[model samples]
Target: MQSTRNKLIDLLANNQDKYISGQHLSEELNISRSAIWKHMKELEKDGYEIEARQRRGYRIISFPNKLSENTLKWGLETDWLGNTIIHKTSTTSTQHIAHHLAREGAKHGTIVIADEQTGGKGRMNRPWHSSKNQGIWTSLILRPEISPHQAPQLTLLTATVLADVIYKETNIRPYIKWPNDILIENKKLSGILTEMQAEQDRIQYIIIGIGMNVNQTIHELPDDLSEKATSLRIETGHQLDMIKLVQAILEQFERTYETYLNEGFKSIKTKWESYGFKIGERINVKTMNQQWEATFSGIAPDGGLLVENKHNGKVEKLYSAEIDWFRE
Candidate 1:
């Protein structure tokens, strides 16, 4: 039902800056005159500038940059990714809501988005700073037909897609840190958290929580994060329209995900290596019981980090390791 209204808005927006008659909308949508009027009024209240003339009917003047379903659906061009969006002004976490929905049988491509998250989290349970209407906090649900061992490739897929989207939108060269973090000029710009549910051989679902700092400024970040966090606005010296960024991400992700499932992770890994952070650079790493300086090579086939320790000149695959890229 709501998707129908969104489709109506998409139609009106397709002819933006031009008049779309109410009668035409009613006929096309198979709704009555009153229903069209009611939906138009609602759109007007949500910061959409619509001009209604008796003879000319209606025209959309502008659209807000909010992440509401209507706004996102206006120009979205994806087949399924983010087609069913659950949006919140403020919430505990989109990841939590997505998990609940997935367990309750939410279909693939269901998206949980929030303008602000009261209890957002990142990899290793780190607190994610999500300011109100300042960043992109969303979770995507996927039910892929793959084994548990092949799940890590989804994180890599997300990293490559996000890196491409950021570069296309802002023209900023985004570097993908080994597993999931995205950096720019050595400052953390975005992060991806991929969690999955699986049995012995079958997979239930995977929820990918993506947090990207979009329009926040240096002053908006906390004192501790001021030195390490950066936003797109801060990097570009101007505010960006969040709707465009989100739409682009969805489109690119859908395409990349389809490619991964159809082709394989070989191409995705190649793209990830193109923007990889500090390739061939020596860096300090600390695992649970070992610490050493190793020369970073590239990603392994299974999405693990490959590095050669300086002590023995032997290379090993690291699935989980803390890296110190700033060490001299």
Candidate 2:
């Protein structure tokens, strides 16, 4: 069931150009006029400017710049992706919270988000810097019907979603480093960590953790990561609305994910490659026992990194390896 507040937002947003009578809002939301007025006061406190006149209904003149469950749902245009949002002001990690929720039978499209993560981690358990209200730190719960082996495709699919949103929102073309990193001008902008729990051939649940640096300034970043990491604000010369960016991501992700389910991985593979960083360029590849150089070809069907072997002219799919993108 949709919350009454969200329903009110939808009713007002759908008719932005005109006023909605208080009686109509009350009838549609099954709430009294006093309750509706109280809700309006709450929205005003959340930074929403609503215009209400005598005999005229209410219309939202502007949305809030803050990030909250209600603000996020105010103008979010998704069917289910963010319908059930678990927002936190500060937490250990959204990923950790998501895992707990999924184990407790959280529904698909349930999202866990935090304004700040005290112990955020990325792939390989690397500590991810999540300053308070400086970036987007969220996790999504997915229960796909596909087998365990096919789960990696979702990671690649998510990369495409991030790249698409970044380009469209900032107008700066970003690149996807093999596996799960979004880069702009050879610097890190965002990272994705995909974890799944499966039994036999069936996946129980998958948690995709996404951490994006959005509004942090140079001084806000750690000194060690100053050169290696970049944020949307740093690159764009202005702060971005975190709520809007999150909505855009959820909207695009839902659309792309639906397409992937209806069709296949072919489209996702193509889109991923288009945003693939350093494709066709020689890069260093490192494994446990050996290191070699290969031309970054593309992504294989099973989500491995496809590289053209420097020797013998054979193509190989690498499931796990440390790719040195900085090395020539």
Candidate 3:
């Protein structure tokens, strides 16, 4: 059921640039004039710029940049993506909330989002700086039919979704720093973490966590991270509508995921290469045991880095290693 507030928003959106009479709204929504006025005031508090005149009624002048459930749902085109959104004003981390929800049988496409994450973490348990209302902290619940070993491919798919959405929205092309880091000008813009729970060869559920630096300024970031991290606003010179970006990501992921499940990883691998960083370049790599410079070949079919040894005529696939891009 639609709330009176959303219905009112619909009326105003439909009658954009035209004044909507309060009396007509009260009658149409079967509410009192005071109720209509209260809802309008609530909308104003939610960042909507509404113009209310003494006799001409109300008009919507602008929309909020918020990513609330209602804002993400409005005009969002997707079949199952974002159908069930768990929105939070502040939390420890959306990934933690999503893990609990997935364990308790949250359906596929259930998204947990927060405006600010106080205890957010990234790959390798590194602390992710999530300033208040500055970035996206969201997690998605997925129950795929593939085996547990194939779960890593989902990370690649997620990388492509983010790359595609960022380019489409900002017109600034981003590079995927293999596995799942999005980079611009060699600075970190986004990170992805994919966690899974499986039994034997079957899969239970997977939680894909995405942390993006969206609207933070240089001073807002920690002094330690200012040299290595960047936000979308810093790169684009302005803030973006959080709701629109989230909706675009969900729609693009759903569309690309359908293709991945039906076709295969052939096309996905190709797309990842196009946006990949430093492919075909000689770079230094550090593993747990060995550190050497190898010729960066490309990504394997199963989403591993294929690097050729410099000393020997041997090409090896590395699933876990750190690429030293500074020395490239």
Candidate 4:
């Protein structure tokens, strides 16, 4: 259910080239002209510059540079991925809020985003530094009909989307590090964490959490992460529009996800491999039993990391392993 204000924004944004008269807005939103005026004032307060004339009704001249539900939805071009957005000024974790919402039967495509996360975490409970207004911290709820075994593919698919978006936005090519990390010039840029709740054979829901360092500076990052973590601003030497980046991610994810569902993981595997970090390079792979060197081959059909053994002359798929990506 879209709120009246959101509907009003949609109407105004969709008609950006022309002004929507107050009468048309009133009739479309089922509100009085006075109420429409109040809504316009509210939008103005939210940093929207709206133009109004006697005969011409209203047109948004500019949108806010803030991260709000309305601001994100204003220029969002997705169908279902972000139709329901839960934005927070501050939260412990977007992933935590998303899990709670999914448990409460939040519909698929419900997204939880925050300007700052007090306790953001990545895969294996590693704390992720999410500075306020400096990055994208978001979790997306999805209820795909695929089995739980196929869930890992979504993480890989998400990496490709991040890489593609970064490339298109900054013209910088990013690498997809095996399970869930996006790297640029051997430094971390973004990460994807996929969590799922499922029965024996059916999945209840899956939450994909993404944290991207967009506008952080060198000093903004913690001292420990200074050597390993890099941000878009640091890489490009310019500030970026987080709202536009978020919109691009959602739009690309929705389209790629639809294609993956209809076509299967074949296409996703190809795309993922194209941006694979250290592909065909020797890397240290550590399993439960032992650690060994293997050439990074490609992704298996089930989304496992395929590595070709140097001594055995055979290819193997590893589902769980610690890869020393920097090892020579």
State which candidate has the highest TM-score.
1
Who wins the lDDT comparison?
4
Per-residue lDDT for 193-257 in model 4, tens only?
Answer: 99999998999999999999999999999999999999999999999998899999999999999
Q: After the best TM-score superposition of candidate 4, give how far the Cα of residue 63 lies from its true spot, in angstroms.
A: 1.9
lDDT measured at residue 123 in model 2 versus the true structure, 0 to 100: 85
Report the candidate with higher TM-score, 2 versus 3: 2
For lDDT, candidate 3 versus 4, the one ahead is 4
lDDT of each: 0.91, 0.91, 0.90, 0.93
Q: Which stretches of candidate 1 lie over 4 Å from their true place?
A: 1-3, 14-21, 53-56
Query: How many clashing residue pairs appear in each of the predictions shown?
Result: 0, 1, 0, 0
Question: What is candidate 2's lDDT per residue for 132-211, written digit by digit as tens?
Answer: 99999999999998889888889899999999999999999999998899998888999999999999889999999999
What is the lDDT for 140 in model 1? Answer: 97
Against the true structure, what is each candidate's TM-score? 0.95, 0.90, 0.88, 0.92
lDDT of 3 by residue, 1-328 (tens): 4657778888999999799999999988999999998888878877889999989999999988787877777777888988889999999999999999998999999999999999999888999988778888999999999989888889999999999999999999999987889998899999999999999999999999999999998889899999998989999999888888888999999999999999988889999999988898887888899899888888998888999888995999988887856362
Candidates by lDDT, descending order: 4, 2, 1, 3
C-alpha lDDT (0 to 100) for residue 17 of candidate 4 = 94
Candidate 1 local lDDT, 1-328, one digit each (tens) = 3476787788877898689888899998999989999998889877898889998998888887688877887778899888798989999999999999999999999999999999999998999999999999999999999888899899989999999999998889999998899999999999999999999998899999999999998899989998998999999999999989999999999999999899988999899999999889988888999888899899998888999989999999988887868465
Indicate the residue-level lDDT of 21 in model 2: 95
What's every prediction's RMSD, in angstroms? 1.9, 2.7, 3.0, 2.5
